[model samples]
Target: MVLPGVYAPQEDTELLAGALSDEPLPPGAAVLDVGTGTGALALEAARRGGRVTAVDVSWRAVCAARLNATRAGLPLRVRRGNLFDPVRGESFDLILTNPPYVPAPDGTRPRGPARSWDAGHDGRLVLDRICREGPELLRPGGVLLVVQSALSDPDRTLGLLRTAGLKAAVIRRRRIDFGPVLRGREHWLRHRGLLSATDDKEELVVVRAELPV
Candidate 1:
């Protein structure tokens, strides 16, 4: 169960989960789920026989994920810290992240539930960091899977990953109606030219970047 203030699994989370199902995890593969809100994706990896560790910047999320993993009878190492911080000096066979990619007016990270989806105006605040740091944590032949909204420019993510020497591409995409946070800022987004007046549905994309085998 998701604790209050922890990000509950949503469409993006499910989309990532489905993609994870296609990944053939070798037995005992080390997996890391950055921004593991409820341990949803982490557990999925564990189910596939990967030894998983989940990292979140929110303490509440870490506690929630830890609790959920215990109840699920899966052993998940959940840690509270900023992206990649808790797992520094360690690498993994796979990294999964559904980071904040909703564009908000302020660039500053929120201190409340808003932190779940409120990314800076361009929504690249967290996405950019993940792209840059993700590869460094990958073992050779490792893969980094990240989901982002179309509004935040998935192409940029692809470019960044490729620039880092990974063979990267959009593995999956889905169109969904705007969530509450996006609905509330529709006008602002349109005004800022990030969205068109007629645009009601946003596209979510999963990018897979693989280090050369």
Candidate 2:
């Protein structure tokens, strides 16, 4: 299955795999992997003895993830629907996601292909939604693992999470240069119509936030 428009699953898969491989999992834990691109993270959880359900809005992504999970000798539930749509009336001990959070060209216009990558005009479209909706999905002491480029506003994202009643914090950071993606970024910022782009040294932040509210 060819998942077009969706950003390719590379770093997220690698990060998720590494995280899951580090230790033995708690018994019979349930996990929710949103925007599970290649089903790699979902598989990682399953491989670690977690009962995982992965959902993607892209049918192609869903098909590919299902196939990948099968090939890896891991059983996973793959659903094709918008974020949080496939699983309703459900809660999990963990939720993992690598959402599209590239801030758009303007504060109003999406900059690039976004079948899966465009978070919103502010680049927090999927992210904020997750924060707003995540509380309901967690199992009291549940955790949410999110990874995103620094272009996405970490402060705002964390604030939103806490406001939504969850305690959020950064778990990891990597200084990644976005010169490739933000080509002409300076020019974009110079525009009178848009807000100035924030200069961040960190390329990405991998966060693990716990829910208490």
Candidate 3:
């Protein structure tokens, strides 16, 4: 399901088809998928019986997701806009994002159409913005799921969620070797005591947090 300008969805994005445990999504759910590169999560939710709004800042991604949805004969509302702007004033029972979380050099915007895959400087540009906006975009009792690399600051992400008034939790984790850029950012995060050895080397995490009902 690789789309225009996007090389492909990452392995972790495919793993989301399991929905954290091969569990079925509750019927009639309203889901929003941010950075819907290959629309994997959005399409998966549709298959599980939820209505979905799939959004990507990249126009290519939006068109591709729409095509993917149409090809599957699935009904999905695909739109193009940055972050949560396109879906403003809307809330979802489930929100999923595989945001760009790569840490680029200071004052640099990493070049790539892996728009859904590249996290900006310090791995927080898109991730931080997402966390800060989650409480407003999610309905009570809704869940927000994220699959991100250890290259990003999980603790910081958790803090951002909590500060936004959500009950955050880490529901899953895995290890994937960091890329050269991420490998370098690890030093800064580790020096700040953000990266943990307990999670194992090159560990990445998929977190789930619930908004209070």
Residues 73-166, candidate 1: write the lDDT tens digits: 9988999999999999999999999999998887787778888898887899999999898999999999999999999999999999999999
lDDT of 1: 0.92
Best by TM-score: 1
- Can you give the lDDT of residue 56 in candidate 2? 87
Off by more than 4 A, model 2: 1-6, 16-24, 106-113, 184-186, 189-202
Q: Which ten residues in a row have the lowest lDDT in candidate 3?
A: 15-24
TM-score of 3: 0.85
Compare candidates 1 and 3 on lDDT and give the better one.
1
Candidate 3 structure lDDT: 0.76
Q: Rank the candidates by TM-score, best first.
A: 1, 3, 2
Q: What does candidate 3's lDDT look like per residue over 110-156, in tens digits?
A: 55563455566567878888898877999989888887766678888
The most accurate candidate by lDDT is: 1
lDDT (0 to 1) per candidate:
0.92, 0.73, 0.76
In model 2, what are the clashing residue pairs, if there are any? 176-203
Clashes in predicted model 1: 0
